[model samples]
Every structure is written in structure tokens, then in C-alpha cells.
Target: MPEIRNILFVMYDQLRHDYMSCAGHPTMRTPNFDRLAAKGVRFTQAYVQSPVCGASRMSYYTGRYVGSHGAAWNGYPLKVGEATMGDHLRKLGMDSWLLGKTHMTPDTEGMARLGLTRDSVIGARVAECGFDLWVREDGLNPEGPDGFYYATPSPYNEYLKSLGYPGENPWHDNANAGVDEDGSVASGWLMKNARKGANVKEEHSETPWLTDRCLDFLASPQAAERPWLAHLSYIKPHWPYIAPEPYASMYGPQDVVPANRTEAEREDPQPVYGAFMNNLIGKAFSRDEVRSEVVPAYMGLIAQCDDQFGRLLDHLESTGRMEDTMIVLTADHGDYMGDHWMGEKDLFHDCSVRVPLIIYDPRQSAGSTRGTTCDALVESIDLTATFIEAAGGEVPEHVVEGRSLMPFLRGDTPAEWRDVAISEYDYSCSVMAGKLGVAPKDAVLFMIFDGRWKMMHAEGGFRPMLFDTLNDPKELDDRGDDPACAETRARLMERLSAWSRRVSQRTTISSDQIIARRGKARSKGVYLGVYDENDLTPELLVPITGAAKGDFR
Candidate 1:
């Protein structure tokens, strides 16, 4: 057999596509990611099949829709017999290993035979997802001694704690707080452990540790022989946005903070956890400090990740693996950061759903396709198929509904890609209502983004949101009812309805004798929110009594 060239998958949890400099956001400092974009292909309209973590990742690993794999939410796991990306790679005689956080299953064995036991921590997920090396902490955030807030003082936590402003007592250090507006007082504790002299693994935080692992993988005997897939997942910039020295002081809150929201955008429905968003703005710091400072700190975290990636790239070149390897970079989902007055994802919106996707392939249809950007709609589901193709394996017939993005990446044929992207979110909001003994009135919502227009439809609510993305890029106005775009609205409704039917059917395995040989599993995709089709577009909602019996499109 020919020598196996490794593939690298770098995922940043909750990173929005538009926030990175390579994605064309002018201010964010992401030289490393931007450089990857420059050397390879950037997807302009990439989206995830589901907004939530486990579901979107399931789609990525299986190349199947969330409706196909049983893992649907953060709490869900891969159903027995479902194939993962690693499983497919292993079948092709390649050794597949998982190093970091595997939320679907807490252990490395959760998916396939590979590296390391599962710690299920954010740091570990980063290591296992793409990196061949491993050092991780699984389980929830460690509790503080006083029980007032979450803290991790494990040997790992102690190392991280050492990075904060020196205090004889770590608890007295005010780690959870942020810097004052003038950058005088400290707020929360810094997460990068090895930065200090404290004893910790080389791969820690969102950058240094992750890059170090990548370099290690490249220099090891494995790089000299076999093809490997390394995932370096970063937990920073997600929340508690506490960065250290240079990163913390690199930018000001006013310099890069997001713009204020208008009343119209704020009027939209607030997720039940409204207090978290409020606290993000001002509670962490004293008066004179608005929430804007967090942006620079967040950007600093991004820069840190970028710097680490630059180092990894240099190592790959030094090891002579750059030409033979393929690099894929993306994120599981996105964070709102105050967009729509929300902090964490689980809401259905572009801010929470669209993620940065970049693919760097050594083989090109035309030499030097640097900085090539494709606007063709792409989703995370397509990743499994792309990887399978790159690794010389046939993409299983029933694996995923997503098509390979290679055509778009090569820029040789743009006509083959999908014209629109779809997004779905499982509603924790509705579930909490039921838990609180309240009526769950809202049905789950689904969105379809055609090139020119974006339509948001909720099953329970009749209010449909239509945004002419070209005119209102911020998506501030809901024009679903505008009479001028009735035809466009009707077309989008059909598309949305058809999509629902398709995924719903594929949610389960076929009982056919042929399919049985392939060992398929039933899907556990979560459906959230409630909507009235008539309210959004009466023409599209049909008078039905039960479930959709077959494909509607």
C-alpha cells in the first residue's frame, strides 16, 4: 500500500463564521486561521445541520443528518451500531484515534478503536477531536471550596489557578471576575495553565496546548509513516472570556466590542435565560465598565488560537507533511455574545448556527488556488463524505444527504453544490417550560437560507421571519408578511416543508433487506419549537390531521 498521508481536523467550539478575520471580519485578529483561508478554500455560507453541539457533531462524524444518527443533543449519545468518521477510517486500514472531548460518548471507545480514554472535558474534546495526542479532564467544572461558583483546582486546575494574579489564597484572587474598564482591577481567573510555572500538560487552554499537541503528532513516528487525523478543539471564547496578559491587554472593550442593539432587534423573543445575557454586559465588572471589554478579550483568545495554529503549520512544513496532508478547520456551532440578547447557543439564529469552515487540500485542479472562497451553501454533514473521499474510501450510500464540497473548493464547478443551507435547533426553552409545569406552547422552528433570502419558520408560532439578507444583512427586519415578496415566500415555504419531510424520513433506518446488511440505526434527532404554517405562509401549510406520511416536496 502507498504511504498514508494524515488529515487534520481543527474544530473550535462555538465559533461564529463571521467573527474571524479570514471570514472577512475586518477587526478580529486571526492571522493563523486567516492564513489557512489564504492557502485553501473558505466556505462563505457554511452552516450546521443542527445548532446544538452533539447533534451537529454527530452529523459531521456520520455524514448523516441528525435525524439519521441517534445523538441529538448535548445529553444524547451515539446509538449502538451507528458508524462514526473514525469507524469508517478504521475500516480503510487507517488507525483512527480520538484524543479530546467526545461528548457523544464520554470515553474514546464511544466511537471506534483509537487513542486515549474519554475525559469529556472541553480541553480533552479539543485533543481527541483532531489531535493524535491526548491529555484531558472529563466531567463537569470542578466546584469551588466555598460552593459559590464552579472551579477546577484539580492538579490541572491548580496549574491554571497559578496563572492568575498571585494570591496566597487562590479563592481570594477573584478569578470569575473580569478586568475593570480601565484594565486596572482583575475579574475572572485565567485558564491557560502552562503559561505559569505550575505543573500541567503541554496542551492546555485554547491555543498553546492545542498547537503543541499538533507539533508533537507531526514529529512522532506516526507522521513518518501513517496518515492521521488530529483535532485540536478550543474551549476559549465560548464564555467566561478570561484571557491572559498579552491577549487580555491586546484590545480594548471599546475597540472591538459589538455594536449596541436597537429596540426592534431586542423586541424579538428572549430565551428563558435572559439573566445570563444581562450579566455578560455589566455584572462582572464595577461601574464604568460596560460589557464591551469582553470582545477584545474574546479576540485575544482567538488570536492565541491563531498563533498556536501558525506554529502547527510551521511544524507540519518542517516535518515535510504539508504537501501530503489535508487540513480541515471549522467549529461545532456559534455563540451569540449578546446578539439577540443571548449568550449561549440553542436558539435558532444565524449568529448561533453559522460556523467558519475552511478546507486546505494539497491537490488542486489548478495550481495555487489560494484565497479561493466559495459561496455555495455547505453544512457540517458534508464533512464525513469529504473526509471519506479524501481518505480513498467510498462515501457510504446512506451515510449522509450532504454532497462533497470538493467541487466548490476546487472552484472548477460551482453548479454542483446546494443552492441553500438549512438549520435546526432543539428547544431547551420549551423543555424547561414543561419542567416548570407550564404549557409548552411553542413548536420547534426550522430555517432555510437561500442565496438571496432567509426564511425562519416556527411550527407553533404563526409568525414567519423573512429577511432579504442582501438588504438587511443584520437580519433586523422580519418581512415574512411583506406583500412584495409573496412569491419568494411561497417558494421558501415549499423548500422548508420539503426539507422537513426528507430529514424526518431519513431519521430512521429502512427495514429493507439490502439496508439491513449495512447495519443502520434509528435516529434520535430532537425537534423543538411550535409553529403554524398558515401564519407564516398559508399557501404552504396543508390541512393535515396527523404526521407527514411521505416526502412532501
Candidate 2:
């Protein structure tokens, strides 16, 4: 077995797979991200369970689908009792720690119902999505007329105060918003001001601040003896669309590639897709001006993220931890960046659901696959199973719906692998649902992509979307209404129906334990059935035959 000691699992928010140089972006280069890919295996087609933040991260942390975990959207609580990657790693004497955002809302109601107090260890772990938080910052500290996004104080805000940014909400002014000549706050939330840079210093920015915290935790003297799974989750490259000084101006509109949309998409859009296109954010991204301003800022934030990766890699190498540690660099989900007539990650487009996944395992077993690329269909939840397997533990398949990628990392491919990639979106409470006149439960969408064909099934009596990726790779054309594609759509729908019928969440106990219990029940004269006399042991047969006849009379 490969001797892996630690896990450096890194996640970037709202990073599209195609944005990285390693993944074939035309202009935006990410050398540090490419460096890790060259030293490891880069997955060409890794997708998240959901396109949004909270639901996607919950799927990743728990190795379960959004429907399974029941945390369907942002601000939705993950119901207590779902086992997470941290919970599984603990069984093998490993500690899982979080250095940054999880986007988790504690299941306060579930805890209350179960009488799990906040002071209790089990309660705290359940509330934290099963990881010990080293420093928790969801990074969206937007302050509005109502209040800050999160009502509580932020450590990032506290750090800004220490740096002489005196304000009630310096996070908005110094970090997320820019200052005008008149000393007015140009909030980054405004799409018009996306071209502007942030007021904070690059070193004090969210990305670098979170990276510094990780470095400090790794360098601490009182580190735990058990192997550690440090989740260095960054909230950058997601929003505010602003970077500090040098990174802010690193790229211009000229550096941005053209948007991946066409007039054809708007000609006769799907009812559900059209409703989303009319959304405020989507309409803004469709305009040439908004794309010109925001794409560069988006690239700048990504550039800063890449630079931080370089710093982290240098530290690990200098400390001689590179060889013993397994580093996984991936994003929670991708951003639209004006693709498919969308602005954010709410649809099933590759720009929204597909994410970059790079894994660097230092074991000699991984040598053969170095600098390689795997085209296998992968899910974000697979990382949970991979982490458990790498730490010398068996994957609880009853709980985890994803397969491990260890075989691929070790230069081997499993004889059988999933041919389709699945992604789901719950838009019941979204603005799109209101525009489409659909109930919340009827606004759900599930995508089934079988490498070449992509089919989307929407609830609320919406027409299913069919795209022949082999022909219309850009997904500019929807063939759901095309009679010629009926068979293809039917086949994919059947596959999706079969997938949904899987027996998920049935593994609270091991198969061995279930079998042992069967034997124990049989020993207590509880026989389910017997087809023949040979089916029963002599002791069990004796009573039925004649041994107890006189006693019964």
C-alpha cells in the first residue's frame, strides 16, 4: 500500500474548469495550477453534484448527493446524522481540519430536536459539517440596508480593524468595495463597478489571508500526531469580482475570450432556460459592456489564487512535506462567466457544473500516472471516498454514493466505470421559478451527460432539454423538441430513472454485522423459512420432526 501521511485538500470557489491554463483556456494562464497538474493526474471531466455553493460543498464533504444529504441550497441546513469525510477519517486515526469556508448552516432545529447542545462535542462537530474549524470565513460579508450577510462579526473584519481600517463594516469598504474620489463606497456587488479594483492590500485580501492561516496552522508546534486532512478552502475567484492593485490590473478586456453564447440560444429558448436568461444577473452578463468589465476582474481574482497556490507549494516543498502529503486542488463548482445565457452557476452547462480537479499523490504507486490526464467521468463526492481509502480505511459504500479514484491515481483503470456524469439543481425557491410560474418542488432539474449526449429533465411540466454534444459541442442548439432525437432522449431518461432508484443511505451497519445478526436470530429459533429439511440444522429439525412430540402433548 502507498504510504500517505497527510492530505492538503484545496478548494477554490466559482472557478470554471476551462479557466485554468492546464485545462486549455486561451488567454488566462494559471501556471501554479498547471504545475500541480503536471506533477499529478488532472481530471478532464470532473463535475460537482450541484452548481451552487452550499449544496455543492455539502455533497463534497459528505460524499452524498444533494437529495441524500437534504441540504439543497444555500442557507439550508444539513440535517444532523449524515456522516462526513471528517467523520470517516476519524475512524482511521486522522484529523480533518478546515482552514476556510464551508458555506454550512448549522442544523439548529435538528440539534434542538435531538437535545444536542452547542457545548457538546458531538453537537459542535455536527454543526460544523464534521470538520474542526481552524478559522471559518464564508467570505461573503456583504453589508446591505438590512445588515451584513452574516449577522455575526467576522475574523477578516477583525483583522482589517487591527490594520487601521476603522469602520463598522470595513469588510465591505476595504475588502469587497472600492472607494471613489468623493470617498463613496463603490460596492463590488454592482456589475457596473466590476472593472474597478478593491481598496484592500493584496496581502490582506481574502485569498492570501486564508492561505497565511493555513501556513501558520501547518507550522504550529502543537500539531496532532495523527495524520491531518487540512481543507484549505478559499472563497476567492468567486465574487466581488475585484482583486487588489497588481492582480486587479493584471488582465484587461482584451485578455478575455469571447462569451460562449449565441443569438441562436435566444431565438427560441427552452421555457425554463429562457426564464433564467431573463434574470437580472443573466441579462447583465449577456450585455457586451458587463462582460468586458467583469471577465477581467474574474481573471484577476483567479490569477491571485494561482499565485497563492505557488506560495503554498513552495512552503510544502521547503518543509519537505510535499512527498508525504497528498494534495488535491479542485473547485466547488464553476462560474458561467457569460456562458449559455447565464451569469452564475445555476444551470447544467459545462461552464457552471464542470470543475477542475487535480490530485497529487506522492506515493511511488502514483509515479506511472504523473503528468497524465484522465477522461473518466468523475463527481465531487468521489474525493470523500478517495480520502478515506488513501488513509487506509474502507469506503462505506452504503453511505457514499461516489466511487474512489485510487485506481486511476495508481496508473490503473477499473474494468468498469461510470459512463455518465450526473448533476442536480434545486431552483424551487429561485427567481426563475417565480418567472416560470412553478412551485418550489417543481423547479428542480437533473442533468445526465454520457460524454457525448447531454439531457436535462426539468420538473414543473417543462420540456426535457437534449443536446448532441458530439455535434453541437457549444450547446447552442437544444434538440429536445426535435423528433429525430427522441430515442436518444428516451435512453438517457431511462438511465437517469435507473440511477434515482439506487438504494442510497442504507449502510449504517456493515454487511458483516447484518449477516451476524441473522445467525444470532436463527440461534434463538427465529427461522425465516425453510424450503427443505436440508435447509435446517439437525437441532432445528429435531423439534419439528419428533424429538419434542411427547413434550408438546
Candidate 3:
């Protein structure tokens, strides 16, 4: 059994847990993802700490909850002092490199306050959410009223231009938006444009391009190290949801699954949930015409993503590195796709929060778990601990809040594990919060799911939301306000409260350090700290008793 020498952490943006055929998707077939699952463990109950991009990725990178990391939304900066997976792996002589998106917003304010310059190596790494960038691209280069979404030129756009897709922003034309016969941009953001294929060559698409970039990195001399973590983050199966060539027409509206919504859900919805349902984006998804036009494109993007995964997998096998590297396929978060009448992922619904987690660990110890499914509750942040442990590094419990899945990968169930999966969202940074008249701090929501029951707690004096997922598998029913479910709601709330009060901030020091310093004050001649002479050594007590004052002096 060779030790797991490297990590290929592949993440797709807005990929739902059930979209893969292996996860029981009735229409979408992701054979490549299924292959990975067959070769390793597929987690049935994996969730992210937050359902949005930046905050969720930060939680995965830092192994901390959103509250602990203090990054509540996309573009929110992860604080400077928090330790990330890169920081942990580096301590064990492994380098963590980023090949694509991290969705990380640099802590510019923290950097300025601490006098950290981005030009410095430490500063650069800090700015990248603790990764050494090997071609960093957040992938979305959408032009808006304020210029591009990122307000900077994209390297991908430059690459597209080099490939003869001439324009200042080919990212919008060839990569994202489709081009009409009149050469006008068919913006993918529009539902009607989803019916058309992207104008880019299939090979030049973002998914394939990012895969090539990863392959190039692997072939590079610098990546010859036996141990490294390469985060191959792809921006796809996300919005601007057009696919290229064959993928565009691969799935039709006929394959689109019916949305998990009902008039019953709309009636007497919780205040926060109601606000999201009425959000502009949510309203768009609520229309049947929009869903009919957009869902096929969404499916096409995922199919393309799966095809790219196959390419990467084939490359690894061809290079004979497949047996040595651990491959983890997951997503930052899941898209709502009109589920619960939502367009994006800003809620705690399963479609929005749960994500597919397939881990292919080639170690001999993982043989028993191969092709097996683990139903244990897990979080996206758990990958940090799993990676550290797989690399033969100690799991820093104080710094990382997630439990390692190494035991499950080794075909062993943990003696005890978390019964519930938690997710959070802070909508204050979103337009929906303003429309709802809720303050930033009060606009936050937390979800706790114990498999059977899912509970949502919103701040700002909003009502709680409860779902008996065992009965309403689609989460169509809200039992939070039901008088019959009062006891169930209270119990779940207690669990959430307990989880929130955990010792999350004692990250700099371990419990062993505190224990080691238990009686140090008395040993340092602080006599008041000791209740009796036995509490201190005789030599120390003699000096403290003034019996050997001259010697002590």
C-alpha cells in the first residue's frame, strides 16, 4: 500500500448532490463521476457550511464554520489570522496549489491593518486564501453596469483571444454567451440564450481549459514533489449555464426533473423563506417558462463537467499516477434550480446545500470501501481533515472543526460521529436582505439536519422552519409552525445552539498546551497559586517558604 502521495481536489461550482446518476438522478447521467464513486467511497449525506461560493470554500479551506471564519458571503474576505488547509499541509512538508477558482476575496483591510503587502510571498499566499496560485481563475468574467463582475481582465479571456476569439471580453462571447448569426452576444444569463450552445470551441471551453491547465501543472518540473495538493476548481455546472457543441444539445427540456415546489410551500412560509421566494432571482425560477428554457443548459453544463473529469482521470491513469494520488470530487455548493422556488443557492434546502462528494483513495487500506457508499453525515469542511490525515499529518483539532473521513475511507465506521449536518447563510450582502428590510447580522440563517428532520433558524425574530424529510423527501412541507412538531423543533434548536457554543476560537493553542501549563504558575514561584506544599516540588517550596532565601537569591 503506497501512501497517498498527492491530492487532486476537483470542485465544480453549483453542482447538486443528486444530479449524478450514481446519486439517483433519474435523467442526468454522469458516468465519469460514477466511475470515481465505484473506485472509492461516495458520501450520501455530505453538506457545505454555507450554500454560497466564497464562504463555503473558505469553510472547506479552513476547516471551520462560517461563524468561526467570519466570511459570511461571496466576496467576503477570509480573515488574515485563520489557518487554512494550505497552512496545515505546509507544516507537514506538502505544498497546496490552486489551479482554478477559490472565490476568495483578499482580506485587504486586514492586510493594510497588519502592514502586509501582496508583493511579498507571505502576503501573496495570504491573499489567495493560503494557496500558491498555479494559474488562479475565478472563471466568471461577466460584464455588468460596474464593468466585469471581478472588475479585472481575465486570463481566460486573454487565452481565448490568443486562440483567435478576438475581443476585449471573449469570456462573455465564446466562453459564456453564445453568438447569434448577427454576431450579437446571446448572454447566457438570459433564459432564452440557454437554448443555444456556447460559441467557443469545445476544447477551448472553461472546463477543458482548466483540466489542461491541471495536466500541465502535473507535468511541470516543480510539481515533481511526492506530496502536493492541487485544487482543480472548475467554474461550471454554474450559471452562464451554456455548454459547447455536443453537450449543448445532449440533454433537452424533456430530461429536466420537475421542481420540488408546491402551492402548499408558498402558503404560510416562514418570513425569511418567504423573502427568498419573492427574491428577483427566485421569482424568475418560479416561472415555468424560465425553468423549461434554463434547466437543459444547466444539465448540459454538468454533463460537460463530468466529461472533463473523465479526461483528467484518463490522463492520470495514462501517466501511472492514478494509483498514488487521491482524487476527491465535490462542489462548493449546490444550485436551487427552481427547487423551493429559488434560482440560486441562498437557502438550506437539500438542493441548494447538499453536494456530491466522491473520494477515490487508491491506498490498499481503502479496498474494502471501494465502490461502497457511506451514509454518515459529513460536511465539505471534513475534506481538510481527511487530506491532512491522508498525508500522514496530524489533524489539528483545535484549528480544524471537522472530523476526518479517513476512518470511513479505511472501511471502518467511526465509534461516534455527528448525527446532523449544518449549513449557514448570511443574506445581508444580498439584495434580498434589503428587500426584506433585515439588517445584516439579523439576516443570517442556520440549518441543522439530523437526516430525518431538518430545521432552519433565522435571526431577526423570524420564525423557525422545520421539515420531516423522512415523510416529505422533497422538503415540500414546512413543519416549523405546526403545533404537532413543537417538540421536534425545540430539540433541533438545542442541538444547533450547542454546536454554536463550541470552542471554535481557541485555534492558536491546543488542549495539551493548556494542560501542560496547568501548574506552571506555582513552579514559577507564584506561591498563591498553590494550595499546599504537595502542589509544588520540595525545592521550589523551600525557596517559597523562605527556608533557603539566601540560596534562592
Candidate 4:
């Protein structure tokens, strides 16, 4: 097998796992995604640590669970000094660069306490989730009466203005919002304008713009100097469901898949689930006309994303870098898209939690596994471990809770892989928590999926939610409160309890390092049970006796 040198870590926001043609979307065809999948291993049951973007992406970067990292919601800063992809890769002489969204807020308070300014490289990396930036754009630069979402002017919006795009914020007005013929701005934030074409040209939209920047970086001299991990994160197929130009009109109601929900799901829904179902986003998507108008636009954005990936793949092939570079195409978290009477991601539905994961490892050893689909339970943090190993370094197991997928890539099953896939959600920031009258600390939810049954455990005294993935694939029926499933619920709850007790906080030292340092105190002259000099080995007392000619005691 040839050495894996570079990693093109690509991510699309809110891309459902089942949307790609390779993943079996009957109407929406993703030729580029299928092309990558054919040359790699596609994971059918890949799950994220969190359902929301910020928390999920932080899990991807940090290689740890949400509970371990503590960045449990959007805008919640990942603690300073948290180990990320770059932190692991740097030790192996690999550089990690960011081209798009991380949704990572800077840990200003932690940095200030440590007297580390963001201007310094170390501090800057800490602020940027351990990656040096080529162009760091989190893509949502909305401005309101309160203030701007971004502290500074967004680089993407500035690029739009330079190209003669009219408006103060072309990112919001042009790329995200649709301009009606009558000269009114139809904000994409409102799902009603989703059927209309975006105000900007196809090339000027977020997907293409970020793709062009990524190509420039890949072609640059700096990129050629060393192996690097380019996190080319595209902020598309997420919200603002507006696609520019031809992509906007590519699909319509005919191509829209029926929402996988039923009226039965609404009957006696769990309290927290009921809150989300009653929310604005949920209620809007619950209507048939809204799904007809919005899903096509959502599909169009994904189609555009696949086209952009085609450009990336072609560039790598032409440059002869495909042989050595590993490409991973995945979403931070899947969008619910009105699945199970809910819109936007949160909760444990497969539509939201199970993201599409395609990994193309350009190595001879991985050739046999190409074009195969692996059903082993994979987590978002596993990519972090895979990258560390591919970059010629071992995974810091104590820090990275996820196991590497390299074994799967090499066509081998792990001796003891995990049976359950876990995901967490922090609803303290959501309106659902307030509606439920739950305190911030108790506004949490956990999921444990063991291939057959899916169980959701909510805090604040709510009953467990259960879904039989084998029997009820669409999860229309909630077996959560069903007394018949008591044994299954208890078994899954025990798995969750075992997972929560894992050694997640002691990350600075590895288990192997601790093992090597075991019984090391004796060599350093602190033998606790030594009755006399004869009680210890002569060599072990060298630290004391071999010191200055004084009493060995």
C-alpha cells in the first residue's frame, strides 16, 4: 500500500444520508457523490455525536463526545486547548487548513484567563478549532437590529460586492434571498421563497465560491510543500434553501419525496417532542405545500454540492494527487426535512442523526474494499482517528473516544467494534426547553442505537422514546411508552449508563502512557512498602544510594 499523504476532508451541512443516489434516493441523482462512493467505502449507518451543526462539527474536530468536550450547542464555544484534528496531525508533520465553516466560536474567556491573544498563531489555532485558515467562513452572516452574526465583514459577502453585486450584504440579499421581479427581497429564511431562484449567479453562490477557494489552495505552492488536511466545508443544503441559477430550477414538486411521517406520530407525542412539533419550523414543514415548495430547493442545493465535488475530484485527478490523497465526503449532520413530523435537526431520527459518510482512501491496501458499503456502526469522531492514523501517527485513544475506520477501509472487521451508536442533544438553547419548563442543565437528550432498536433518553423526567428500525423503518410508530418493550429499553439504558462512565475527561495522557509509568515511583526512590534496603531491588534504590554519599533513607 502506498502511503496516504493528504486528506481532503469535505463536509456539506444538513445533507441527509439517503439523499444521494448511491444511498438509494430514487429521484434525486448525485452522480458525483456516486462516483466517489464507487471508488471508496460508503457507510450506511454513520451517526454523529450531536444532531445540530455546531455541536456535531465540534465532535468531528475534537474526536470526542459532546459530554466530554462540553460544546453542546450552537454558539457554545469549544473549550480552549481542546484537541482537534490539527492538534493530532501537527505532531505527524501534517498541516491542517480550513476553507469553510466550522461553526466554532472562539473561547475568548479561556484565552483571556491564559493571557493568550488571538493574534498569536497558537491562540489563533485554538480559536479556529486547531486549524490554520485559508479562508474561514461559517457562512451565516446575517445582520439584525441587535447586531451582526459575524464580528467582522464576511469575506464571502465582500467577494460578492467586489464583483458588482448590489446591496450592503450580498451574502444575505443575493446568495441566500430571492429577489422578486417586482424588486422585493424574498428572504430564504422564510421557506415560502424557496421555490424562487436565488438573487445571485450560480458561480457566485456559497458552494461554488467555496469550491473555487478550495481549488486555489490545493493548487498553491504552500499546499505542495507538505501533507495537509483541507477541511473544505460547504455551507449548503442547510437553511435558506435557495439555489442559484440553473440549480434552483433543476427540480420541482415532481422530484420531491414524500415526507416519512404519519398522523399517528402526532398522537400522544412525548412532551419534549411535542414542543418541537408545535414549534414554528415544525409546523411550517408539517404542511404538504411547504414540503412541495422546499424539498426540491433542498435537493437542488445538494445537486449543486455534488457538482462542486466533481470539480474537486477532477482537479485532484489532473494533478495526479488522487493516488496519495484521501478524500472523505460527509455531512456534519443530516437535515430532518419534515421527517417524522419534524423539520430541522434535533432528536434521534435516522433522517437527522444518520449522515452520509463516503471515504476514498487512495491506497493499494484499500482497493479491495472500494465500491463496498459497510454497515458497522461509525461515529463522526471516528474520522478524526482515521486521519491521525493515515497521517502516520497512532490515535490518542484517551483523548479520541472513537475507533479508527482504517480497519474497515483495509477490508477487515475490528475484533470488537461497538454494538451501539450514541448521539447527544443539548436543548437548553432551544425554545422547546423553555416551552417544556426544563432548566438549562436538564435540557438534554441522549440516543442509543443498536442496529435494531433506537432509544432516546430525555432529561427532566420524560419517558424514553423507542423506535424499532427493523420493523418500523420510517419510525412512524413510537414504541417509547409501550410496556411490551420494557426489556429492550432497559438493555439500551444500561448501554447508555456504561458509555457515560467512560474516561472522557482524562485526555492529556494516554492509557498506554499511564501503563508505561506504572510502578515507576520505585525507580524514582519512593517505594511505599519498603521495610528496609533489602525490601527493594538494589538498582531501584540507586536514586537514593547512588545520590550523594549520605544516608540512603
Among the numbered candidates, top lDDT falls to: 4
User: Candidate 2 or 4, higher TM-score?
Assistant: 4
Which regions in candidate 4 have their CA more than 4 angstroms from the true location?
A: 532-534, 538-553
lDDT of each: 0.61, 0.89, 0.89, 0.92
Q: Please give the distance, in angstroms, between residue 298's alpha carbon in candidate 3 and its true position after superposition.
A: 1.1
lDDT of each residue in 501-530, candidate 4, tens digit only: 988899888888899999887777687977
lDDT of 1 by residue, 355-474 (tens): 899888877452456688887778888887777777777766555576776666566775555777887655534444444343333535567898779887765435577889799887
Using lDDT as the measure, name the better of candidate 1 and candidate 2. 2
The weakest ten consecutive residues by lDDT in model 4 span 541-550
lDDT of model 3, residue 64: 92
How does model 4 fare in lDDT? 0.92
What TM-score should be assigned to candidate 4?
Answer: 0.97
lDDT by residue (352-379, candidate 2, tens digit) is 8889999999999999999999999999
- Please give the clash total of every predicted structure, in order: 38, 0, 0, 0
Task: Score candidate 2 by lDDT.
Answer: 0.89
**How do the predictions measure up, each by TM-score?**
0.74, 0.96, 0.96, 0.97
